[model samples]
Target: MGLLWGITLLWAFSFSLIGVYLAGQVDAYLAVASRMALALLVFLPFWRPLPWRQALVLMATGAIEIGIMYLFLYKSYQYLTVAELLLFTIFTPLYVSLFADLFARRWPKHLWAPALLAVAGAAVIRWTELSEDYWKGFALIQAANACFAFGQVWYRHQSKSTSLTHRARFAWFFLGALLVTALASALLADWQKLPVTPVQQGVLLWLGVVASGLGYLGWSYGSTLVSAQQLAVMNNMLIPAGIVVNVVIWQGQVDWLRLGLGSVCMAGALWLCRRQSS
Candidate 1:
């Protein structure tokens, strides 16, 4: 549990920082493609070759899980600030909770108020992004967040199956993710022109190996270890950490009033999550 928490914290920090990197780097999809390629290269040897059957599943998961998510993320980063990007994330847990209720036949109890609070808080945080450009970015990031929620739940379901070791499955998934993201990027992005930088390469490498691969694997493992409700509760902590990290590391502005509102949102969300868990 502690390791999982650490991994998640690292994941959160890494993702927040990647915005600055992506802002300066090559095309977003291309960056994703490159990172996936690098991660695949690193993970394949450790996990061994895969059978064609499992590879297909990996490919599908990768396309939705990585390909589309990265595409829009990059697109969103183009217009949205890191804080704005994260503000949209407040909707993901709410979406997942609602979806789980519809499909699984039981909604998270006592989540209504907290979810609403979170939404309001997020709106306040993102109030500055009411411009047309920010609105578009907001929509894109929301889409990515929705996809990420789906991916986590779907991958959790897969974790329960006996078809393959988690490590191996993760590796195959990375390989498929690379291929899918690469093709998607090629189709969607202009390869003729791209930002070139040494730091960009370094950031991409870190994102691939440390952030996506290990961070995801750890988060998945934690989800499997802990109840979804508990994980959901803890997930709110990421907001404060994100805000702080942004203010300190990125030299971003701090709106104390918004931060206070975010705290209330997190408190409500946590309370609801705990209640749901019990």
Candidate 2:
């Protein structure tokens, strides 16, 4: 849970940074490819052999979760405001809860209430008038959300190895992501849009090394420790956290009333889940 919380803060900054610094300035495919490549480099040294089956599963997880998901996310930014993108992701908790239950073949009914509450909290925080591109951006973000939710649940349940084993072989996950992103960048990227400025390059390096590499590792491992309900609720935490980052760093306008209300709702959701579990 602590790991998840820590990564949540780190990823909140990532959300703001990408939206402000990289989304429109850099080629989406190139950004994704570069990030994955850099992350791959970080883990490559620790790589070890795993059974063919486990290796394949982890690779597939990475490809879908980060590789394909980033494609949807980065492209959606062209059609959506950062706030809209964040708001649309409110559905992710529901997706996570549903996928976790489906994979387990048993419904933990208690999970649903808290998950729904978390979604409501996120919705409250970002509610606004809809633009013409709402449906398109919504669809793209939903696809990304579903893929991310599925990957987290699948990896948390399917990977039965000890922590040491997971670390030793985790590079394969990024390799799989790299294959997808690299292929996309090669085929679809606008070469003219590559990062040229020092800030862009530095941001890419930070995102790739610390955010993608360390953040994903922490998040994946953290998922193994918490209940699916807790993980589901935690997904919504990113919304307020990201908004706070934007407010602090980017001087983005924020509605204090809504922020306070949403925070209360999310806290209530967390408390409810914890009480139920206890």
The model with the greatest lDDT is 2
Q: What are the lDDT scores of the predictions, listed in order?
A: 0.68, 0.88
User: What does candidate 2's lDDT look like per residue over 1-278, in tens digits?
Assistant: 89999999999999778878887799989998999999999998899888888788889999988998888887787788866887798999899999988988986678799999999998999887778757888899999999899989988877664454666556988988999999989899999998999999999999999999998999998998888889999998988898898899899889989998998999998898889889
How close to the true structure is residue 104 of candidate 2, measured as C-alpha lDDT? 83
Return the TM-score for each candidate structure.
Answer: 0.82, 0.95
Q: Encode model 1's per-residue lDDT on 1-278: one tens digit a residue.
A: 57556875676576556667665546767777877877776667667666677677766666667767777777787787866677677776676556545545675675455556656666565455444568888789888876766666666666676567667777777776787787887688767536466776778778888877777667766767765554544555566666677788788778888778867776676666566667
Clashing pairs in 2: none
Worst 10 residues of 2 by lDDT: 160-169
Q: Which portions of model 2 miss their true places by more than 4 Å?
A: 161-164
Model number with the top TM-score: 2
Q: Could you give the C-alpha RMSD of every candidate to the true structure, in order shown? A: 3.1, 1.5
